[model samples]
Target: MFSHIQKIHFVGIGGIGMSGIAEVLLTLGYKVSGSDAQKTTITRRLRRRGAKVYYGHQRENLKNPHVVVYSSAIAPSNPEIVEARRLDIPLVARAEMLAELMRLKYGIAIAGTHGKTTVTSLIANILTQGGLDPTFVVGGKVKSLRTNARLGKGDFLVAEADESDRSFMHLSPTIAVVTNIDPEHMEHYRDYDELKNIFKEFCLKIPFYGVAVLCVDHPAVAAIAASFPKRFLTYGIHTKADFMAHKIKLYPFKSSFELKINGKSAGQWRINLMGSHHIQNALAAIAVGNELGIPLSSIKKGLSQFKGIGRRLEPLYKNEHQKIYVIDDYGHHPVEIRETLNAIRQTWPQARLIVIFQPHRYTRTKALFSDFTKIFDGTNELFITQIYAAGEPPIHGVSAKKLADNIHSNSFNVHYRENLNDVVHDVRGLVKKNTIVVTFGAGDVNKVGKQLSKMMKEMPLQ
Candidate 1:
């Protein structure tokens, strides 16, 4: 694919996933250029790495590149995309470019509705510790690495395969990991059964020699295991599987578990992430390590050294004397929110839970309205922000105010804040001592938690 291509341009370069891929391509000696609606920390970093980044997509930003790649978030009518089409430059989807990159290396693509970022980072860390020097492209920044993508000397290229648009079908990975499957991306599928078949098709994309590591604990994932006879491996906690965790122990901000492969005790493993969801995420990585024949000791050490992704329940600040704890997570889905809340409760059962949530896309808010209303009972205080329209036209009755009102009507204490420009002001009175302030959303709602943390850090102790 790179036979005559020297430069590549991206349409939505500042996106979390697109930035990672752009970085990898930059490191591989390609002249990279991209344009986004706004300049972000990602764009600045890419600029530092010799990428030509332009703000506000214009036809003029489409420099004469051999090929152009665009983010899924970008609309088809984007000026750069239209310009590329008129200029006769080959235009590619972001996943198509990712697939081309994977074609050049031994790919390990992690796919699922959730946990793909953490799982990809864990596998990369383990492989690195095992002396593979593997390349990785994660959707979120890894705390330890301080970056989301790297081009390594080894042959393996581990990446997070996105399923939001069913773009994950573009790659043929040597080891495919499906953490779990749920009814998500309903915009892409007609029904749940169709989504299941799409995932199964993704698993079947692997060659005869490749393996699909699935989480059978999810009935949808297990339902598709029959698609690949001997080509599938299983990993789970509640059910007996090929790779499983047992005797799990979770502490504040950390967790450990006994590892069992093929029903035989491999060893006890520990990771620097909390919650059963994290434990399940670790199991997926462990299964990958075991499949690669990486020594168990290396796997254990890698997991222990893992500091986790930036927003997968990342703690922004902690002050025991002031009893102020704040965390931010990229959990917009109901299952993710439930698991994160469960993890928080398991770690700090006594702390008063305060959640600030912002709905992401209008489509998702409307599709999962019932589930969203049901998950807020456990929180002592809840602050709901207006929906962030991520380039989507608003659905008629799918405002965040409606969701908040519905939850309030359910006899829960919910406060709706329409403006988040001053998120701290919107909920300052609610931040009492001995409370764990957590932000749940994929949008800028995390700013609330960040602001709260800053306020707590600067405030004098009583």
Candidate 2:
């Protein structure tokens, strides 16, 4: 804690990562203020906790702040950032601030291209259930805790290390977990080799006495494990690892599998979360729990009781009378969409699976165009909307319609809707007695599922 720096302001404070850190700072009795382009529940919650919240950015928002923290989403040319620089005040990246917070505690940082949020939440929940009330700052809201961040009295500090901006490298944690590695955040690295190298470096940052948990199923991660020269634990289903899950059984909303430690059966475990991906996440938590001397019983209870994080296959609305269920997920990448849709298909094999997918970034859509075309095969009907720019200038040749056309060429039931309202309206008409609707993406496409769920609730049973 910086005694001299009393006030800390955040730019783009509404971001999940930014908000969590802000909440932690508030709990530490610091004067926290922040600005975002829009007011959200997270921002309002911070305001109620005595942090000054601003709806829009302005030079005046930076008044008398000892330091300013900005997320990767915020541009350097923003008014508040310019004002901070003009005033000669210290400026920090969001990851820099998070690194400082972890520096003081026995840190456990989770990093990967995907499943970081779920893995971090699982570890946090396991640690919490074991009676070590740890300080946690995750990217998504853990439904069990109802908040993304908490300052605890225990010695552990758990957080998700974001690699999208290559900022996760700044963190040096006592225990580090890398779920998997893929070709993502291409904007940050020169190539796939660079991305892999950075992860190797990140794991090596662990002290001699520390440990690194890795997933061996992903080839890239497996490669990193081969190169890592330190204490490490490996977990996966397809690959032989230190921690492994086998004999998996998948249900509509849950899965059970046998857990093995070092090729010996530890126990049978079940998780409410779906997909093989989630099972791998739980395995990471188990490795961490065992390493920290927590009983397997506590880890089992923690995994079983985890309600799941928001927007990671979160059930938005369920209508028993109408026999309709709606799920919202933040899966914009091709691999994520493929796995998520596969889980939905396995869960409800009889229901008509209708998907409303909004492509996340122009760059991502452009880079993974072919993969998107092939990933939606599990859906009965697929609706595509315009790409969510996510602050990037539109790429000239990339558009949602083109993606739809490419998918259509493969004889898939895909449609392009230029308007979200029209897509929602059409979805309302398309609902049948046995239907499961899911809105998929990293952007505002979730609004379509929410509105449709509301409309379904108001409809009477036939």
Candidate 3:
């Protein structure tokens, strides 16, 4: 699709979404260059793959590029972007580039507010195991592949459709999967209805011969499916749909369930993933696999063998000596946090569930404050830090301390730590036998979990 474009430069190349596309273009033998505010592993990996990487944006960074791609996080005022526009270089949004890549293959785009990464990773795993060798791009690093993007020799291309900026509308996938829709990214939409309508439009993008896969368990998703005019299939735990999972058994680190496809029992399935949320994610992958004519045995094996993606209930360290377990998760939304805590409780019924949470964005925290207060029911103890503003200006009257105070008023064990260092120290002193310390949020909260784990490892045996 980008045959005439010889050189491509990305504005925010370190971002997970942007880096993936950069890697794919590099693999395709395109001259790739990009700039980010900071250096990260993703950027380093891209540089190693023969792409020129810059630590920060500059007008000079846009030199001799046929097209410039900028991520949603980048602003129009960025120096590189300004230079590109001034020079009349073709500037494209990251989603536009991703859509162009999809245009060259049978695209399978996974869209939703949550579970998109997991479902995309699961589908990629299933396709790889089935000998499809589909090219895939996911938001998070897949533990099995150790990377977020790969270029394969197959005709299928699997990708995660980002809805935060409503850029997912740019993608017209041959096979589309909507895991679930929730009230998120309110900054971009007027209300929940508008968000739901956008999801409907995304589903309608599928061609006449293609199909849309949706989760019927979510009431919002189910309601949208009713009005969908094109071919679609539903999967869920509570609803009787085209694909379903039943008799689910949740364990500490794994779950198993019976799978059914179109009212017929496919077989039993198991995954090394925890929680009902993850089970639903696997069910969506099952739907895609079934539609692609992959054998049930291969699907089962792929799901069962799947290790997991980074920052999704990933266990960082387990100290048998101190009986402390450290886990990190990238769940900033109230529903995601609630489900993650529920999973932790179901897995370790006897352990004290201590949560160290860093609220992601001030706007999100302000928008979902009420929901956050009630979602920590399973949390035995809560420690919150200052908000991690993902490039947005701090919204007045919205602070993590305020959230901690409100949650504390609800009679739950809540504490407010000013920073990650304080959290690490507090956790070091509070951790006792059978304590499950889970760092929660989409920001740098995982760093606290890693530090706590390192501290636990250095403690004297006792």
lDDT (10s digit) by residue, model 3, range 280-322: 9999998899899999889888887789999999989886665
Error of 3 at 144 (Å): 1.0
User: Model 1, stretches more than 4 Å misplaced?
Assistant: 409-412
Q: Model-by-model lDDT, in order?
A: 0.88, 0.91, 0.90
Ranking by TM-score: 2, 3, 1
- Model 2 clash pairs? none
Q: Which ten residues in a row have the lowest lDDT in candidate 3?
A: 404-413
Look at candidate 1 and tell me the lDDT of residue 226.
Answer: 52
For candidate 2, give the lDDT. Answer: 0.91
Off by over 4 Å in 3: 320-323, 409-411
Alpha carbon deviation, residue 1, candidate 2 (Å): 3.4
Which is superior by lDDT, 1 or 3?
3
Candidate 1: tens digits of C-alpha lDDT, residues 31-114: 999998887889999999999999998999977899999877888898888899999999898999899999989899999999
lDDT of 2 by residue, 88-150 (tens): 999999999999999889999999989999999999999999999999999899999889999
- Using lDDT as the measure, name the better of candidate 2 and candidate 3: 2
TM-score of 3: 0.97
Location of the lowest summed lDDT over 10 successive residues in candidate 2: 406-415
The alpha-carbon deviation from the true structure for residue 16 of candidate 3, after best TM-score superposition, in angstroms, is 0.7
